[model samples]
Target chain A: MNQTIIQEVRETTPLIHHLTNQVVMNFSANGLLSFGAAPVMAKAEEETAEMAANANGLLLNIGTLTSQELPAMINAGKTANERGIPVVLDPVGVAATPFRTNAVKRILSDVQPTIIKGNAGELAHLVEIPWETKGVESVGDGNADEIALKVAETYQSAAIVTGKTDVICIGSEVVHNHTGHPILGKITGAGCLLGSILTACLTTNKSIEQQALTAVQFYGLAAEYAAERPDVNGPGTFLSHFIDALAYDPAKLERE
Target chain B: MNQTIIQEVRETTPLIHHLTNQVVMNFSANGLLSFGAAPVMAKAEEETAEMAANANGLLLNIGTLTSQELPAMINAGKTANERGIPVVLDPVGVAATPFRTNAVKRILSDVQPTIIKGNAGELAHLVEIPWETKGVESVGDGNADEIALKVAETYQSAAIVTGKTDVICIGSEVVHNHTGHPILGKITGAGCLLGSILTACLTTNKSIEQQALTAVQFYGLAAEYAAERPDVNGPGTFLSHFIDALAYDPAKLERE
Candidate 1:
């Protein structure tokens, strides 16, 4: 599934529009660019709708949402919906703030997202359950796979809950056991890059299940490959190597 | 001057607050980070003042400014002025749009800029001249070095004009004919990175002259080094190798 999706993504190289937090915008753009996708980040209220419509995929992230950016997200999401472009919602820190949660809820209502990618706690909170959010990090109530399945079922969308192991779910069919490295957390924008990667996959892979599973597995695999290098000592070096690996890897989608 | 500034920059590693455009924010941040400085990009209206006051240097760039971001720039600039934090203005694309020109004018009027950096046309436009702006790319008039010096004296600030040859002016004293690479323009955000690098220099190099000269020279040297690699086929590879060189180079500020 990963290899198939990678081949398709390399061939298609979709343009993805991201309305995300300031912290991860460049990394997400660079990551997508590295993965051979074009990224246009037009967050201004005036041009977001136009940008979204022209893009093959839309990614909405509420990591650091302000009152000013909310309307633009809704407008972009609506344009994406009208155009039948896939929208991936990254509900970053959804459980952390009322503003973020409300924004996520509103965006979800407006966009009718193709996928919702979040951590265990963020997913739990989105489904209206109590969860622990540890400063943009997540502490799970139980196993991530079970929670991922429940969230996917509840939202009626493909759910990706990423941790040490990534879990991808489409209704009842859950793809579990993705291998990634702990060093990924040290690198900023890792999750956001995954969301962009997922966007790239969903744009090219016709099968929804294949798209979600492949993106999750391949993203983890890339992280694993990057972390294996001894010189990739810290997050910054790891990030550089990871993007370099993703950009040049001939077998990007093949699970080793 | 270059050696003194590089030594100071590495020793001080100041926190720089940047109210810059989206196109160069990541590169600027990473350049500052590589030079051992902390870069805080708080562009929202609510936090710009606080962030600016807390930082050691403030960098304002109008390259990719939307109508919404102009106020934040002004707010940050004003705060930096009040706190005596060195404010460096990169009037990018100032001659390209009426909005950008007006914004740069407003900021200059209210806040005293420590250093003003741009290509010849941008500097000329900031001083209200009939300078030719060939799209966002400006080669400047033949007397760009003279133009930069005159602008620096007029504004009572250090002026930096960069191109194939870079120029730095501090009052009556001027440094001209610094060398760099032609391929620097192939990669976006090179100018913006220069601004951030100067901010890094300001933290350590006490004199504005050393800061301006060292930053431009170091960046040029790195770009020249990157150009030496035949493997740098495009902007992506060039960007990666440029960064890697910055991280690895022992004498980034060595004088020719």
Candidate 2:
């Protein structure tokens, strides 16, 4: 797969502003830093517009959405839209509660995201596809490809549906990437970090579809390499190695 | 240091209710889980009282304190106090912004935290001690031992003052633990995890001072062991190995 995008991300070092969930903030920041991008998390409603205005990209994740931050997220997305920078929205666990479902709908109505990323169940909720979910964990699949296309077509934005076989779609075009590890399933912020790195990828001059595809491919590959290490016994060890792999050359990713 | 506390934690599997900052939620949850304690993060004011009432312990960390969650934190701490369960208050970066400082002050006014934990600078800020700090990272030393004692006396809660030499104090009694690695300084949430695991320690029948001391000692030892691993090169690798060390037997921590 094209690695130049990765090189471009490193050279550009885009600053992605995050108004994300409380669960994965630090991990996403470190992961973005490891992937050669800068991350700034500014969630206070007072400064969302200002921070988003200065950022190269904006990521809105509602993993642990609070009522207080919803307006801030809308403002941040609007600022990013006005600036013509990428706005990646990850509607984390939208099916878990009515609060989340309504909040995401409110966001979609107010802002135009460049890309919307989530697991099968989460993205499926956006398109009214029936899917099973427990809390924030999405294991049920609703035909990921169709969900991606529907989400993309519905929102007039690119869609990244992550699962066993990841699917990305934009404007009737679809890309399938099979490059991740199950170890990612064991960790907490794996998907959140993907949204973060994907935001970084979008900051590059590459086409939106290819940028999202590369971000997914690189994230999966990093997970594969990290999980394959001999010293990586389980999720605990795999998480750290995953961060390291984000910074490591794919060739040097596995020394085990 | 006694290792039986580790066994107690594993056997009991106490549920720790956290109303912590956004940045370290996932890491703290993973770290606490690795340490054999269950973590429940419920910050919404609507559920904080209920979650804390059911929890074995409650941890209130203002690392990224926002105005929206201050009331939730206060309610959670009050609930934990009423239930006679241990409440750990990690006033992270209290000196950074007036928002954090005022939020902590407000929480302290309404709720009686069982134990107050912070870096030297953060604790100092509570007691009006002058200590230089940049943002949330506290490198200035304002006599952590004294700050711990003063904070304990002022708040009627045990205080854990973390720095190069970790100090834990309660009711004029203090414990100094020197067992951690500098690598811990490289990673985020090291202190937050200590507050988490320490909250687990507090749930035991042991005295609060002893429980806090043991938590600091065990955490430092885990960092030392994780940092000493041959495969651990930088902060990225050290963090994963550190999580493993949290779960590993103290004896099996550093085989490499």
- The DockQ of each candidate is 0.06, 0.20
Task: Provide C-alpha RMSD values for all models, in order.
Answer: 6.9, 6.3
Per-prediction interface RMSD? 5.6, 3.5
Q: Output per-candidate TM-scores for chain A, rounded to 2 decimals.
A: 0.94, 0.96
Worst 10 residues of 2 chain B by lDDT: B247-256
Residues B100-148 of candidate 2 have per-residue lDDT tens digits of 8888889899889888988998999999989999888887855888899
Candidate 2 lands at a TM-score of 0.66
Candidate 1 residue lDDT tens string, B1-256: 3566666666666778878887777677666666556566656565567667767899998888887787888888898888888999999888888887788888888888999998888888877666777888886567776778788888899999887778888998888756577777887888888888887777663677767787777777777776666667777666656665554443642422
Estimate, for each residue in A44-92, the C-alpha lDDT of model 2 and write its tens digit. 8999999999999999998767787889999999888988989999998
